[model samples]
Target: MALNAAVALGSMFFGLVALFRPQAMPGRPLTSPGSQMTQPSEATTYFARMYAARAVPFGIATAAVCILLPSQAAIWLLAAGAIELLDAMVVASRNPREAAPPLLAVVVHIGSAVWLMTA
Candidate 1:
Protein backbone atom coordinates (compact mmCIF):
# COMPACT_ATOMS: atom_id res chain seq x y z
CA MET A 1 0.00 0.00 0.00
CA ALA A 2 2.68 2.39 0.98
CA LEU A 3 4.70 1.39 -2.01
CA ASN A 4 1.84 2.01 -4.36
CA ALA A 5 1.26 5.41 -2.86
CA ALA A 6 4.88 6.27 -3.35
CA VAL A 7 4.81 5.09 -6.95
CA ALA A 8 1.70 7.07 -7.64
CA LEU A 9 3.14 10.18 -6.13
CA GLY A 10 6.40 9.71 -7.94
CA SER A 11 4.65 9.15 -11.23
CA MET A 12 2.69 12.33 -10.78
CA PHE A 13 5.80 14.25 -9.92
CA PHE A 14 7.68 13.05 -12.97
CA GLY A 15 4.75 13.66 -15.28
CA LEU A 16 4.36 17.15 -13.99
CA VAL A 17 8.04 17.73 -14.39
CA ALA A 18 7.88 16.59 -17.97
CA LEU A 19 4.93 18.81 -18.64
CA PHE A 20 6.30 21.90 -17.02
CA ARG A 21 9.93 21.46 -17.94
CA PRO A 22 9.81 19.87 -21.33
CA GLN A 23 12.47 22.27 -22.46
CA ALA A 24 14.65 20.93 -19.71
CA MET A 25 14.60 17.53 -21.32
CA PRO A 26 18.16 16.50 -22.04
CA GLY A 27 20.13 14.29 -24.46
CA ARG A 28 18.63 16.07 -27.42
CA PRO A 29 20.06 18.81 -29.56
CA LEU A 30 19.20 22.24 -28.33
CA THR A 31 17.97 22.90 -31.78
CA SER A 32 17.63 19.70 -33.67
CA PRO A 33 16.73 19.67 -37.33
CA GLY A 34 13.71 17.86 -36.09
CA SER A 35 12.79 20.97 -34.19
CA GLN A 36 12.18 22.65 -37.51
CA MET A 37 9.84 19.83 -38.24
CA THR A 38 6.31 20.57 -37.20
CA GLN A 39 5.76 19.57 -33.66
CA PRO A 40 2.91 17.23 -32.47
CA SER A 41 3.07 16.30 -36.16
CA GLU A 42 0.03 17.71 -37.87
CA ALA A 43 -1.49 14.32 -38.22
CA THR A 44 -0.54 13.16 -34.78
CA THR A 45 -1.39 16.33 -32.98
CA TYR A 46 -4.29 14.42 -31.52
CA PHE A 47 -1.97 11.85 -30.02
CA ALA A 48 0.31 14.49 -28.65
CA ARG A 49 -2.60 16.41 -27.31
CA MET A 50 -4.00 13.30 -25.82
CA TYR A 51 -0.79 12.63 -23.97
CA ALA A 52 -0.33 16.16 -22.78
CA ALA A 53 -3.96 16.70 -22.14
CA ARG A 54 -4.46 13.52 -20.25
CA ALA A 55 -1.31 13.53 -18.25
CA VAL A 56 -3.38 14.31 -15.22
CA PRO A 57 -5.88 11.59 -15.90
CA PHE A 58 -3.15 9.08 -16.35
CA GLY A 59 -1.62 10.06 -13.07
CA ILE A 60 -4.94 9.89 -11.33
CA ALA A 61 -5.65 6.48 -12.78
CA THR A 62 -2.26 5.31 -11.68
CA ALA A 63 -2.94 6.45 -8.17
CA ALA A 64 -6.34 4.87 -8.14
CA VAL A 65 -4.93 1.59 -9.28
CA CYS A 66 -2.20 1.76 -6.76
CA ILE A 67 -4.56 2.46 -3.92
CA LEU A 68 -7.24 0.10 -5.04
CA LEU A 69 -5.24 -2.73 -6.49
CA PRO A 70 -1.57 -2.73 -5.90
CA SER A 71 -1.01 -5.87 -7.91
CA GLN A 72 -2.32 -4.26 -11.07
CA ALA A 73 -0.75 -0.90 -10.42
CA ALA A 74 2.64 -2.07 -11.50
CA ILE A 75 1.63 -2.73 -15.07
CA TRP A 76 0.33 0.76 -15.61
CA LEU A 77 3.15 2.41 -13.71
CA LEU A 78 5.67 0.38 -15.64
CA ALA A 79 4.08 1.29 -18.92
CA ALA A 80 4.07 4.97 -18.07
CA GLY A 81 7.65 4.89 -16.89
CA ALA A 82 8.71 2.96 -19.96
CA ILE A 83 6.99 5.39 -22.24
CA GLU A 84 8.64 8.40 -20.65
CA LEU A 85 12.03 6.73 -20.59
CA LEU A 86 11.74 5.57 -24.17
CA ASP A 87 10.76 9.03 -25.28
CA ALA A 88 13.84 10.39 -23.62
CA MET A 89 16.01 7.74 -25.21
CA VAL A 90 14.59 8.36 -28.64
CA VAL A 91 15.19 12.06 -28.24
CA ALA A 92 18.73 11.40 -27.07
CA SER A 93 19.58 9.00 -29.88
CA ARG A 94 18.09 11.03 -32.66
CA ASN A 95 19.60 14.34 -31.58
CA PRO A 96 22.80 15.42 -29.93
CA ARG A 97 22.16 18.34 -27.68
CA GLU A 98 21.77 18.26 -23.93
CA ALA A 99 22.01 14.79 -22.48
CA ALA A 100 21.82 15.65 -18.84
CA PRO A 101 18.20 16.43 -18.04
CA PRO A 102 16.53 13.93 -20.28
CA LEU A 103 18.90 11.20 -19.23
CA LEU A 104 18.51 12.13 -15.60
CA ALA A 105 14.78 12.37 -15.89
CA VAL A 106 14.53 8.97 -17.51
CA VAL A 107 16.75 7.40 -14.95
CA VAL A 108 14.83 8.93 -12.11
CA HIS A 109 11.46 8.02 -13.54
CA ILE A 110 12.38 4.44 -14.38
CA GLY A 111 14.26 4.00 -11.18
CA SER A 112 11.33 5.21 -9.11
CA ALA A 113 8.89 3.09 -11.03
CA VAL A 114 11.02 -0.01 -10.63
CA TRP A 115 11.59 0.65 -7.00
CA LEU A 116 7.93 1.22 -6.31
CA MET A 117 6.88 -1.84 -8.20
CA THR A 118 9.35 -4.00 -6.31
CA ALA A 119 8.60 -2.46 -2.98
Candidate 2:
Protein backbone atom coordinates (compact mmCIF):
# COMPACT_ATOMS: atom_id res chain seq x y z
CA MET A 1 0.00 0.00 0.00
CA ALA A 2 2.79 2.42 0.80
CA LEU A 3 4.41 1.61 -2.46
CA ASN A 4 1.13 2.06 -4.23
CA ALA A 5 0.66 5.41 -2.63
CA ALA A 6 4.11 6.48 -3.66
CA VAL A 7 3.51 5.46 -7.23
CA ALA A 8 0.15 7.17 -7.29
CA LEU A 9 1.67 10.35 -5.99
CA GLY A 10 4.35 10.18 -8.60
CA SER A 11 1.77 9.78 -11.32
CA MET A 12 -0.20 12.68 -9.92
CA PHE A 13 2.88 14.85 -9.99
CA PHE A 14 3.49 14.10 -13.64
CA GLY A 15 -0.11 14.78 -14.43
CA LEU A 16 0.27 18.16 -12.82
CA VAL A 17 3.32 18.76 -14.91
CA ALA A 18 1.22 18.00 -17.96
CA LEU A 19 -1.44 20.38 -16.79
CA PHE A 20 0.94 23.23 -16.16
CA ARG A 21 3.41 22.62 -18.95
CA PRO A 22 1.40 21.19 -21.80
CA GLN A 23 3.97 22.50 -24.23
CA ALA A 24 6.84 21.10 -22.22
CA MET A 25 5.36 17.73 -23.06
CA PRO A 26 6.74 17.74 -26.58
CA GLY A 27 3.50 16.44 -28.04
CA ARG A 28 1.53 17.50 -31.03
CA PRO A 29 -0.75 20.50 -30.78
CA LEU A 30 1.11 20.86 -27.49
CA THR A 31 4.70 21.26 -28.67
CA SER A 32 5.72 24.67 -27.36
CA PRO A 33 6.83 25.25 -23.84
CA GLY A 34 3.66 26.30 -22.05
CA SER A 35 2.18 26.40 -25.54
CA GLN A 36 -1.51 26.85 -26.11
CA MET A 37 -2.64 26.42 -29.66
CA THR A 38 -3.35 29.83 -31.14
CA GLN A 39 -2.75 29.59 -34.84
CA PRO A 40 -3.38 27.69 -38.05
CA SER A 41 -6.53 25.78 -37.16
CA GLU A 42 -9.12 26.06 -34.44
CA ALA A 43 -9.05 22.30 -34.39
CA THR A 44 -5.58 22.46 -32.91
CA THR A 45 -6.88 24.78 -30.24
CA TYR A 46 -9.73 22.42 -29.54
CA PHE A 47 -7.40 19.49 -29.26
CA ALA A 48 -5.18 21.37 -26.82
CA ARG A 49 -8.19 22.31 -24.77
CA MET A 50 -9.40 18.75 -24.71
CA TYR A 51 -6.00 17.50 -23.69
CA ALA A 52 -5.83 20.05 -20.90
CA ALA A 53 -9.32 19.09 -19.79
CA ARG A 54 -8.46 15.41 -19.58
CA ALA A 55 -5.52 16.10 -17.31
CA VAL A 56 -7.76 17.07 -14.43
CA PRO A 57 -9.64 13.81 -14.43
CA PHE A 58 -6.50 11.78 -14.70
CA GLY A 59 -4.94 13.73 -11.87
CA ILE A 60 -7.97 13.23 -9.68
CA ALA A 61 -8.12 9.55 -10.36
CA THR A 62 -4.47 9.11 -9.57
CA ALA A 63 -4.74 11.11 -6.35
CA ALA A 64 -7.80 9.11 -5.37
CA VAL A 65 -5.94 5.89 -5.83
CA CYS A 66 -3.30 7.21 -3.52
CA ILE A 67 -5.58 8.53 -0.82
CA LEU A 68 -8.88 6.66 -1.02
CA LEU A 69 -7.99 3.09 -1.84
CA PRO A 70 -4.61 2.31 -0.46
CA SER A 71 -5.27 -1.37 -0.33
CA GLN A 72 -6.44 -1.70 -3.91
CA ALA A 73 -4.87 1.39 -5.37
CA ALA A 74 -2.17 -0.57 -7.08
CA ILE A 75 -4.68 -2.50 -9.12
CA TRP A 76 -6.53 0.59 -10.20
CA LEU A 77 -3.36 2.50 -10.92
CA LEU A 78 -1.99 -0.33 -12.98
CA ALA A 79 -5.13 -0.50 -15.05
CA ALA A 80 -5.21 3.23 -15.63
CA GLY A 81 -1.53 3.32 -16.42
CA ALA A 82 -1.88 0.52 -18.91
CA ILE A 83 -4.69 2.31 -20.67
CA GLU A 84 -2.60 5.48 -20.78
CA LEU A 85 0.35 3.54 -22.14
CA LEU A 86 -1.74 2.06 -24.92
CA ASP A 87 -3.13 5.47 -25.73
CA ALA A 88 0.37 6.91 -25.78
CA MET A 89 1.52 4.28 -28.23
CA VAL A 90 -1.43 4.97 -30.44
CA VAL A 91 -0.65 8.66 -30.32
CA ALA A 92 3.04 8.12 -31.01
CA SER A 93 2.52 5.68 -33.83
CA ARG A 94 0.08 7.97 -35.52
CA ASN A 95 2.22 11.09 -35.11
CA PRO A 96 5.71 10.44 -33.97
CA ARG A 97 6.85 14.02 -34.28
CA GLU A 98 4.49 15.35 -31.66
CA ALA A 99 4.14 12.30 -29.47
CA ALA A 100 7.58 12.31 -27.91
CA PRO A 101 6.79 13.71 -24.48
CA PRO A 102 3.63 11.74 -24.09
CA LEU A 103 5.48 8.62 -25.10
CA LEU A 104 8.06 9.35 -22.44
CA ALA A 105 5.38 9.91 -19.85
CA VAL A 106 3.66 6.71 -20.86
CA VAL A 107 6.82 4.73 -20.39
CA VAL A 108 7.32 6.26 -16.97
CA HIS A 109 3.74 5.55 -16.08
CA ILE A 110 4.12 1.95 -17.20
CA GLY A 111 7.19 1.52 -15.05
CA SER A 112 5.45 2.97 -12.03
CA ALA A 113 2.41 0.83 -12.71
CA VAL A 114 4.54 -2.24 -12.89
CA TRP A 115 6.17 -1.33 -9.63
CA LEU A 116 2.83 -0.66 -7.96
CA MET A 117 1.40 -3.91 -9.22
CA THR A 118 4.41 -6.01 -8.37
CA ALA A 119 5.51 -4.39 -5.19
Candidate 3:
Protein backbone atom coordinates (compact mmCIF):
# COMPACT_ATOMS: atom_id res chain seq x y z
CA MET A 1 0.00 0.00 0.00
CA ALA A 2 1.04 3.58 -0.56
CA LEU A 3 2.12 5.90 2.25
CA ASN A 4 -1.09 7.88 2.00
CA ALA A 5 -3.15 4.73 2.30
CA ALA A 6 -1.16 3.69 5.34
CA VAL A 7 -1.64 7.07 6.96
CA ALA A 8 -5.36 7.10 6.27
CA LEU A 9 -5.75 3.55 7.48
CA GLY A 10 -3.94 4.37 10.66
CA SER A 11 -6.03 7.44 11.24
CA MET A 12 -9.25 5.57 10.58
CA PHE A 13 -8.26 2.69 12.79
CA PHE A 14 -7.32 4.89 15.68
CA GLY A 15 -10.41 6.99 15.26
CA LEU A 16 -12.62 3.94 15.28
CA VAL A 17 -10.89 2.65 18.33
CA ALA A 18 -11.23 5.93 20.11
CA LEU A 19 -14.85 6.17 19.16
CA PHE A 20 -15.72 2.74 20.43
CA ARG A 21 -13.25 2.60 23.29
CA PRO A 22 -12.27 6.00 24.48
CA GLN A 23 -10.54 4.56 27.50
CA ALA A 24 -8.11 2.78 25.24
CA MET A 25 -6.53 5.96 23.99
CA PRO A 26 -2.89 6.36 24.84
CA GLY A 27 -1.52 9.29 26.88
CA ARG A 28 -4.91 10.16 28.26
CA PRO A 29 -4.72 10.62 32.01
CA LEU A 30 -7.40 8.33 33.36
CA THR A 31 -8.38 6.63 30.13
CA SER A 32 -5.06 5.31 28.91
CA PRO A 33 -3.92 1.94 30.15
CA GLY A 34 -0.47 3.28 30.83
CA SER A 35 -1.69 6.20 32.85
CA GLN A 36 -1.55 6.16 36.63
CA MET A 37 -4.94 7.73 37.09
CA THR A 38 -7.70 5.28 37.89
CA GLN A 39 -10.89 7.15 37.27
CA PRO A 40 -12.19 8.25 33.89
CA SER A 41 -13.75 11.67 33.49
CA GLU A 42 -16.46 12.92 31.17
CA ALA A 43 -14.28 15.60 29.65
CA THR A 44 -11.62 13.20 28.44
CA THR A 45 -14.21 10.79 27.16
CA TYR A 46 -15.96 13.59 25.34
CA PHE A 47 -12.73 14.69 23.71
CA ALA A 48 -11.86 11.18 22.62
CA ARG A 49 -15.24 10.63 21.03
CA MET A 50 -15.16 14.04 19.40
CA TYR A 51 -11.71 13.36 18.01
CA ALA A 52 -12.96 10.14 16.50
CA ALA A 53 -16.04 11.80 15.07
CA ARG A 54 -13.91 14.40 13.35
CA ALA A 55 -10.89 12.30 12.37
CA VAL A 56 -12.65 9.30 10.85
CA PRO A 57 -14.49 11.31 8.21
CA PHE A 58 -11.50 13.51 7.54
CA GLY A 59 -9.33 10.49 6.93
CA ILE A 60 -11.84 8.91 4.57
CA ALA A 61 -12.39 12.10 2.60
CA THR A 62 -8.71 12.84 2.30
CA ALA A 63 -7.90 9.33 1.12
CA ALA A 64 -10.80 9.33 -1.29
CA VAL A 65 -9.79 12.65 -2.81
CA CYS A 66 -6.18 11.60 -3.11
CA ILE A 67 -7.18 8.47 -4.97
CA LEU A 68 -10.06 9.78 -7.06
CA LEU A 69 -8.49 13.10 -7.95
CA PRO A 70 -4.76 13.40 -7.76
CA SER A 71 -4.68 17.09 -8.61
CA GLN A 72 -7.06 17.84 -5.79
CA ALA A 73 -5.17 15.50 -3.54
CA ALA A 74 -2.63 18.18 -2.79
CA ILE A 75 -5.23 20.29 -1.00
CA TRP A 76 -6.59 17.34 0.93
CA LEU A 77 -3.17 16.05 1.82
CA LEU A 78 -2.11 19.46 3.06
CA ALA A 79 -5.23 19.65 5.14
CA ALA A 80 -4.45 16.28 6.64
CA GLY A 81 -0.93 17.47 7.37
CA ALA A 82 -2.27 20.62 8.95
CA ILE A 83 -4.36 18.57 11.34
CA GLU A 84 -1.22 16.80 12.42
CA LEU A 85 0.52 20.11 12.84
CA LEU A 86 -2.30 21.29 15.05
CA ASP A 87 -2.12 18.12 17.06
CA ALA A 88 1.63 18.55 17.35
CA MET A 89 1.19 22.05 18.64
CA VAL A 90 -1.40 20.94 21.16
CA VAL A 91 0.69 18.00 22.30
CA ALA A 92 3.77 20.16 22.50
CA SER A 93 1.97 22.59 24.72
CA ARG A 94 0.96 19.79 27.06
CA ASN A 95 4.00 17.56 26.81
CA PRO A 96 6.91 18.37 24.59
CA ARG A 97 8.23 14.81 24.66
CA GLU A 98 5.06 13.41 23.13
CA ALA A 99 5.04 15.74 20.13
CA ALA A 100 7.62 14.06 17.88
CA PRO A 101 5.39 11.49 16.20
CA PRO A 102 2.69 13.98 15.22
CA LEU A 103 5.34 16.37 13.96
CA LEU A 104 6.74 13.54 11.83
CA ALA A 105 3.27 12.80 10.52
CA VAL A 106 2.91 16.44 9.58
CA VAL A 107 6.14 16.17 7.59
CA VAL A 108 5.07 13.02 5.76
CA HIS A 109 1.63 14.33 4.80
CA ILE A 110 2.81 17.78 3.78
CA GLY A 111 5.90 16.49 2.00
CA SER A 112 3.92 13.97 -0.03
CA ALA A 113 1.41 16.64 -0.98
CA VAL A 114 4.17 18.98 -2.03
CA TRP A 115 5.80 16.29 -4.14
CA LEU A 116 2.50 15.51 -5.77
CA MET A 117 2.00 19.14 -6.68
CA THR A 118 5.52 19.57 -8.01
CA ALA A 119 5.46 16.35 -10.00
TM-score for all models, in order of appearance: 0.43, 0.52, 0.80
Instruction: Give one clash count per candidate, in the order shown.
Output: 5, 0, 0
Residue-level lDDT of model 3, residues 1-119, one tens digit each, is 16775676677777898787776766653544555565456777888888898789987877777677767688788889999888778768767888887687788789989898898
Report the C-alpha lDDT of model 1 over 4-70, residue by residue, as the tens digit: 4554455456556545554443333133346663232332343334445555566567668767876
For each candidate in the order shown, give its overall lDDT on alpha carbons: 0.53, 0.56, 0.76
Better of 1 and 3 by TM-score: 3
Name the lDDT value of residue 31 in candidate 3. 49
Better TM-score candidate (1, 2): 2
Global CA lDDT computed for model 1:
0.53
Pairs of residues at least 3 apart in sequence or in different chains that clash in candidate 1: 26-102, 27-98, 27-99, 28-97, 29-97
Stretches > 4 Å off in candidate 2: 1-25, 28-40, 94-119
The worst-scoring run of ten residues by lDDT in candidate 3 lies at 28-37
In model 2, the Cα lDDT at residue 100 comes to 56
